[model samples]
Target: MKSMTGYGRSSFLCENVEVSVEVSSVNKRNLETVVSLPRDWQALEREILTLTKEVVSRGRINFSVKARVDKAERPEASWDEKRLRDDLEQLRIFAEAEGIPYHPDASLLCRLASGQKFEQSLPDPTKMTEGLKQAAQEALKAMIQTRIEEGKHLEADIKARNAEITCLVNELEVSSEGISALWREKLLERLRQAELELDAEDERVLREVALFAERCDVSEELTRLRSHGELMNQILEEDGPVGRKLEFALQEISRELNTVASKSPSTEVKRLVIEARAECEKIREQALNVE
Candidate 1:
C-alpha cells in the first residue's frame, strides 16, 4: 500500500557537476507529471517522466532538477573579441538600415558575455544523464517509503471506520426484524378505532401485510453491504493502486446503505443506516489518498 502524497530530494556528484533532484506528489484521480529542468537540460524531461511513471501509478507528481559545477572546476567566462566585434558591426548596420538608433554600452557587452557565462556553467546533458537517473531513483525511493508509511496509517483508519459500518449494519439488521408485523398490527389498531374490524387472519389483511413486507425488506441490501465490506478489506490488502478499487467498493457500499435507509420502516433501522453511511463516507474520503 502507498499514499498519493510524499516528497523526496537527492543530490550527487557527476564528474565536476553536482546534480540534485527533488520529487513530490499530491492526490489526483489519474497519473500526471510536471518536470522542471535547467533550460539547457530540457531534453531530459521525457526521460524523467518515464522514470516517474515506473514508480507512481497515480498522483500529480512534480520533478525538479538542478545542476552546478564545483567552483574549483568552473571555467572562467570569456568573450571571443573578434566574434563580439563582428556581431556589433552587423547589429549597427541593421539598425542604420532600419533607421533605428543603435547604442552599444557595457550592459550590452555584459549581456553577450552572460550568455556564454550561462553556457559555461551548464553541464552536458549526455554526460549528466547517468547521474540524473541515479539521483532521481534515490529520490523516488525515499518518496515511496514515505508513501508506504503514510499508507499504513490510512489503512488503519479506513479499517477502523469500516468496522464501525459493520457494527451499524448489524444493529440495523437486529432492529429491523418484525417491522412488517409491527406495521400490520398498527394498521389493524387504526382500523378498529375507525369502526372497521380487520382480523389478522383475514386473506386481504394477510396479503396486504405480505406486500408491505416485500416493499420494506432490506435483507438483500444488507447482504450486499456485507459483501461490499468484505471486498473492501480484500482490496485494502491487495498490492498496488487500490484507490480506484476502494473508491468503487465504497460507491457500492453507499448505494446499499441508501437502499436500506429508504426501504426500512423502523426508525432505529433508518438511524443505523444513516450512521453506517456516514462511516462509509469517511472511508471514501480516506480512500481518495490511497494508491
Candidate 2:
C-alpha cells in the first residue's frame, strides 16, 4: 500500500555541471506529470515523463530540473559578425531606396546579431540528456519511497479501524439476541393488555410474529460483514494497488448494512447498524487515498 502524496529531491554532479531534480506529487484520479526544465534541456521532457510513469502509478506529479554549469562548462553565446554586417548594409540600402530615413546604429546591429539568427551552441545534448534522466529517476524513486512509508502508517490506521468495526459487529450480534428476546416479551405483554386469550387459534398470530422477527434478523448481514472485513484486510495486505477493490468491498458492506438497518425493528439494532455504516464510510474515505 502506498499513498499518492509525497516529495523527493536529488542532485547529481556530472563533470563541471550540477543537476538537481525535485519531484512532488498530490492525490489525483490518474497519473498526470508536468515537467519543468530549462529551455536547453527541453528535448528530454518526454524521457522524464516516461520515467515518472514508470515510478508512479497515480497522482498529479510535478517534476522540476535545475542545472548549474561552471563558467568554463557553460556554452558561450556568439554571433556571426560578417553576416550581421551584411544584413545591416542590406537593410540600409533597402531603406534608402524606399526614401525612408535609416538610422543604422552599432547597438542595433549587436542586438540583431544576438537574436535567433545567430547560432548559440549548447552543451553536449547526449550527456545532458542522460544526466537529466538519471537525476529524475533517482528523485522519483525517493518520492515513491516516501509515499510507501506514509502508506505504512495509513495501512496501520485502517487496520485498527477495521478491528474496531469487527468488535462492534460482535457486540451487535450479542445485543441482537437480547433484542429479539425483549421483542418477544413486549409482544406478549401487548397481547395480554388487549385482553387476548392464549388459545390454539393464537398459534397463527405467534407464528406470524416469529416470522417477522426472522425477517428482521441481521445475522446474515453480520456474517457477510465479517467476510467483507476479512477480504478488506487481505486486499490491504497484498502487494499492489488495491484501492478500487477496497472501495468495491466497502460498497458491498454498505449495501448489506443498509438492508440490516431497514429491516431492524429494534431501536438498539438500528443504532448498531448505523454505527457500523459510519465506520465503513470512514474506511471508504481512507481508501480513496490508496494506490
Candidate 3:
C-alpha cells in the first residue's frame, strides 16, 4: 500500500553548476505531471515526466527542476554574420542615397547582434544525464518511503473504523429478530379489530405472514456485507495501485448498507445502519489518498 500524497527534494552541485529537483503530489484519479524545468533546458521536460512516472502511478504531481550554471559555463552571446552583413549593407546603401555619414563602430554592431543570443546553455552533458538523474532518483526514493509510511497509518485508521462498523452490523442483526414478532402481532390485532377470526396457522395467514417476512428479511444483505468487508480487508493488504478498486468496493458497501436500511422494519436496525454508513464514509474519504 502507498499514499498519493508526498513530497521529496534533492540537489546536486558539481563544480560551478548546481541542479535541484522537487517532486510533490496530491490525490488524483489519473497520473498528471506538471514539470517546470529551466526555460533554457525545456527539452528536458520529457525526461522529467518519465522520471516522475517511474515513481508515481496515480496523482497530480508538481515536479520542478532548477539549474544554475556559472557564467563561465554559459554560452556567450554570438553575432549572426549573415544577418549583420545584410543590415550593414542596407545601411551603407541608404547612407549613400541620402548623402549621410554611415560609418558604424563595433559597439553599435555588437548591440544589434546581442538580441540574437542562443537560447541554450553550455552545461556538461554527462553531468545532466547522469548527475541530475541520480539526484531525481534519490528524491523519488524518499518520497516513496514517505508515502508507504503514510499508507500504514491510513490502514490502521481504516481498520479501526471498519471494526466499529462491524460491531454495529452485529447489533443490527440482533435487533432485527424482534421485527418479525412485532409484525405478526400487528397483523393479528388488525384482523381482530375488523371482526375477522383467522387462525395463526391457517394457510392464508401463513402465506401472508411469510410474504411480509421475506420483504423485511435482511439476512442476505448481512451476508453480502460480511463478504464485502472481507474483500475490502484483502484489498488493503495487497500491493500496487489499488485506489480505483478500493473506491469501487466502497461504493458496493454503501449500496449494500442502503439496501439493508430500506428493508429493515426495526427503527434500531435502521439507526445502526446509518452509523455504519457514517463510519464507512470516513474510510471512503481517507481512501481518496490511496494509490
Candidate 4:
C-alpha cells in the first residue's frame, strides 16, 4: 500500500545551467496532474505527465520546474573586443572620406561598444530534455518513498480499527442470543398486567415467541459483516491502489451493521452495533488516503 500525500524536490546542474523539479501530491478520488514550466518548455509537459502516471494511480499531483543560467559563465556575457575595434576603425575612415570630423567622442565609443555587446539568448529548452528528465525522475522516486513509509502507518491504524470492529460484532452476536427468551418473558408479564391469564406453554404464546425470534434474527447480517471483514483483509494484503475496494467493503459493512441494529431489540446489541459502526467509519476515513 502507498499513501496519496507526499512531496519531493531535486535539482540538476549542467553546462552552466541548473534545473529543479518539485512534485507533490494529495488524496483524490482519481488521478490528476498539474504541470508548471517555462513558456518555452511547454513541450515537456506531456513527458512529465506520463512519468507521473507511471508511478501514481490516485491523487492530485503537482509538478513544477525552475531553471536558471550561471550569469558569470554565460557565453553571451563575453566581450568581443576585436570586433568592436574593427567597427570603430571603419566608422572613423568613413567620416574622414566624407570630410566630416574623424575624431571619435566618448559617447561614440560607448555607443559602439554597446552595439557590439551580444544579445543574451537563452539556451533551447528542447536541448535540456535529458537533464529535466533526470531531475523529475529523482523527485518522483523520493515522493513515492515517502508515500510508502506513510502507508505503513496508515495500514497499522486501519487494521487496528478493523480488529476492534470484529470484536464488537462478536459481542453483539453473543448479546443477541437470548433476545427471544427475553421477549417471551416480557409478553407473559404484559398479559398478567392486563389481568388475562395465559399459560407460559400455550400454543399461541409459543407461536408468538417463534415469530418474534424470526423477526429479530441477525444471523444473516452478521454473516455478511464477517464476509465484508474478510474482504477488507484480502484487499489490504494485495498490492497497489486498493482504496476503492476498501471503500466498497466499508460501505457494505456499514449497511450490514445498520440492518443488524434495526433487527435486534436488546439494548446491549444496539450499543455494540453502534460501536462497530464507529470503527468502520474510522477505517473508511483512513482508506480514503490509501492508494
Choose the strongest candidate by lDDT. 1
Model 4, residue 172: displacement in angstroms?
0.6
What TM-score, over all chains together, does every model reach?
0.86, 0.78, 0.81, 0.83
* lDDT to native, each model: 0.87, 0.80, 0.82, 0.86
Question: After TM-score superposition, what is the CA distance of residue 31 in candidate 1 from its true location, in Å?
Answer: 0.8
Pairs that clash in candidate 4:
241-291
User: Which pairs of residues collide in candidate 2?
Assistant: none
lDDT of 3 by residue, 1-291 (tens): 888888888998865667888888789989998988754566667777788788789989887787666667666766678988887899899999999998899887876665334224536454476677778888888888888989899888887887787788788789888787788889988999999999888788888888888999998888888887888888888889888887888898899899988997788888898899999999999999999
**Which model is ahead, 1 or 3, in terms of TM-score?**
1
- The positional error of residue 227 in candidate 4, measured at the CA in angstroms, is 1.6
Per-residue lDDT over 1-291 for candidate 2, one digit per residue giving the tens place of the 0 to 100 score = 998878899898766667789999988778899988765567888999888877678789999887666556445566677877788899899999999999978888767765523224345556777777777878888998989998898899889888888898898787777565666677777778899866534776678667878887888988998999999899998987777888899999889888877877767778888888788888888888887
Q: What's the CA RMSD of model 1 in angstroms? A: 6.0
Higher-ranked by TM-score: 2 or 4 = 4
Top-TM-score candidate index: 1
lDDT per residue as tens, model 1, 1-291: 899999999998877677789999899999999999876788888788888889899999989887776566667868678867887899899999999999999999988776556556777889877778888899999999999999999999999998888888888889989999899999899889999977889898899899999998988988898898889899989998999999999999988888888888778887887788788888888989998
Error of 1 at 261 (Å): 0.8
